[model samples]
Target: MQYSIGELAHRTGLTVKAVRFYSDRGLVPPSGRNAAGQRRYDDAALARLDVIRVLRDLGIDLATIRRVIEGETTVAEVAAEHVAAVEAQIGVLHRRRAVLNAVANRSQPEEASLAHQRLLLSEVERQCLIGDFLADALGDRPELAGIARTLTPELPGDPSPEQVQAWTELAALMRDTDFRANLRRLVDAHEGGLRRDLAAEVRDAVTPALVAGIGPKSPAARAIVDGLGRDPGELREWLDAVSDPRRERYLELLGVINGWAAPESMAPAFGWLAEVMAA
Candidate 1:
């Protein structure tokens, strides 16, 4: 029922060094010593070593394993805690695999990969980034308080590659103070006056022209402007205020982050309106 350190190692299929480490760590103590002063283990020691090996293979760290062996914690409790830890590690590995797959598919340059990796944020980080930005921008507006919550982006539990990329970029943009200011300005202007209704009207009127491939400077642009039932000059001014490239990019990124289908570019529509009004 007793075994030397080397014999225990061979019987348990563990390395001799590993067995010695456990012995030194007091996880598996020697019951006695042989005449040559070598360590010897009894049945209880061998049984304890077996449990340590099993727990270690289950990804339990040495500290927790020691706690379980020392009777400071139950094996079931340790197993439960370690299971949660292992599950979390698996989730991280899954996300890393997803990122690598996306990188491989795009054949992206090294710099692009580095940029994407830098921008990638965990779900909690993504939510905090967006929530902080919106809080700073629309937090004081009682009317928009609910709307801001509705507009908040939550990436799906299992996101597509495009969604992941969009989220990374969106998080970066959310952290930029200038971008936050720009969005605040847009929100403020929209809430201030008739400009609130003008955006939707413009979207409707110019969508046809953009679809028709009408150039911004074309005479046909005037017809689109006329359809909105606004003075050409007034329409042009409104377009100038709202046709920001960053705003468009924000919407594009928002669509992806929110799992919305891609929206048509409003650039062409606004372009036509601006040209016609300026003329």
Candidate 2:
């Protein structure tokens, strides 16, 4: 049986003009003209129209839909390809949202406005930029290469907004000359674990004093410092090297990107050590 274009449109919930356009495009051709010389569609055309409607709803372009109707491609093939395309688009959108959140979290709102230029970086590019900074900062300290690797940030395939923001700000921090110098100084101080050893001793001896609220120049602090048996000059040099705000922020951002537990700040202990040296 044949149905007029009007009847087919009414049944399919498509406008009459839409049905005509599809017929003209040969996607749903008329079977034959009716007695009134109007377009009429057979059951086959009606069924094909149903498919076109579904494919269009799924965001499949008209050309691909036409291929499906023409039997040039299988519906399953088209659907699978479309699904992959849609997932890729969603991934892009996810990354874009992460970038936006990173910019918004900046304390300086103007930084966010300026961040759009850097938002085009891919994950590999991000890693490369960070690696270059680490290489330059660490210099030829082959012994400290492992430390450099640990400090490097790797963005996961699906990162949180906080992670993205941390990475972005960290990248900016890496470009600062003072920040680079501070890191190199700290790295140079690591003579066969000398830096770590002193830090461990300081933490152990001075932690109790800190807890007791002993002032840095107090007699109790002096006793702790002397008992630790570290050279005051070396202690001063180490504190001067590592006790930088950007250095601390770099470690914080590393933790953020790696999902590591927040590191305890040694700034207070270092500040106390500096005071003991002055005494």
Candidate 3:
């Protein structure tokens, strides 16, 4: 049986304008024309319109829906492709929502909110930031190249608020050109044989002193320096350069991003070492 555009729309539960649009887009063709040149459709047109509606509701764009309706591709193929696309979009929205909730939890100022937002980098950006930083710092040195990868931080799949904040701060630090240059200089200086593992060794040995709350210039700091087998004067200079508050902050941030345990402060131990050398 033949039906006019309005009748077809009424039967299909679609707006007349939508049905007309589908017709214009060639998704649903008219079976014939009425006496006054109005479009009339048959059962085939109704069926085609139903398919278009279903596809559109499934988040398929009109272009793909048209392809499906035209049999250019199978419905199953199109549906599968759209499902994957929808899933990806859902993942993005989920991450964004997590970030917004974290911002709300802190009740940060507008500037802080913007700063956090700027750090919401995609996976590629995160990798590039870390890769470039390590490459610039340790790429030429064969000995340190492997260590660079070991120090890299990978964010968790479901990151916590702390992780989000840490990542934001780390991203900011990585982007600072001067900070990058300084880090490079520090790495290059350490390439000298005398203090190759000085930072790591200090972090390990001085952690005990820091835990004990010894001051930087205290006599007790001498014990920590002696334990590391370094001369007090040389140890003090290394501590001054390597025990940067910012570097400690960076590791703290890295732990947050990676969901690792928070590392203990090495500042106290270094403080004690510095003081011992001065004395």
- Give all TM-scores, in the order shown: 0.67, 0.62, 0.70
lDDT by residue (75-117, candidate 3, tens digit) is 9998787776777577667667667767777754985667566
Best by lDDT: 2
Count of residue pairs whose backbone atoms collide, per candidate? 0, 0, 4
Residue 259 miss distance in model 2 (angstroms): 1.0
Best by TM-score: 3
Better of 1 and 3 by TM-score: 3
Q: How high is the CA lDDT of each candidate model?
A: 0.75, 0.81, 0.75
TM-score of 2: 0.62
Candidate 2: worst-modelled 10 consecutive residues by lDDT? 191-200
Model 3: lDDT to the true structure: 0.75
Return the candidate ranking by TM-score, descending: 3, 1, 2
Over 4 Å off, model 1: 107-111, 119-128, 135-148, 156-158, 186-243, 261-279
> Candidate 1, clashing residue pairs?
none
The alpha-carbon root-mean-square deviation between model 2 and the true structure, to one decimal in Å, is 7.5
- Model 2, 1-279: lDDT tens digits are 889888989988899998889999999988888678888889999999899888888999999999999999988999989887787677667778888777777788778776765654765677678877888788876777788778888776567988777777888897787788887777777763446567777777777788889998788888888887657666677779877878888889999989999988888887887888798
Error in Å for residue 191 of model 2: 2.4
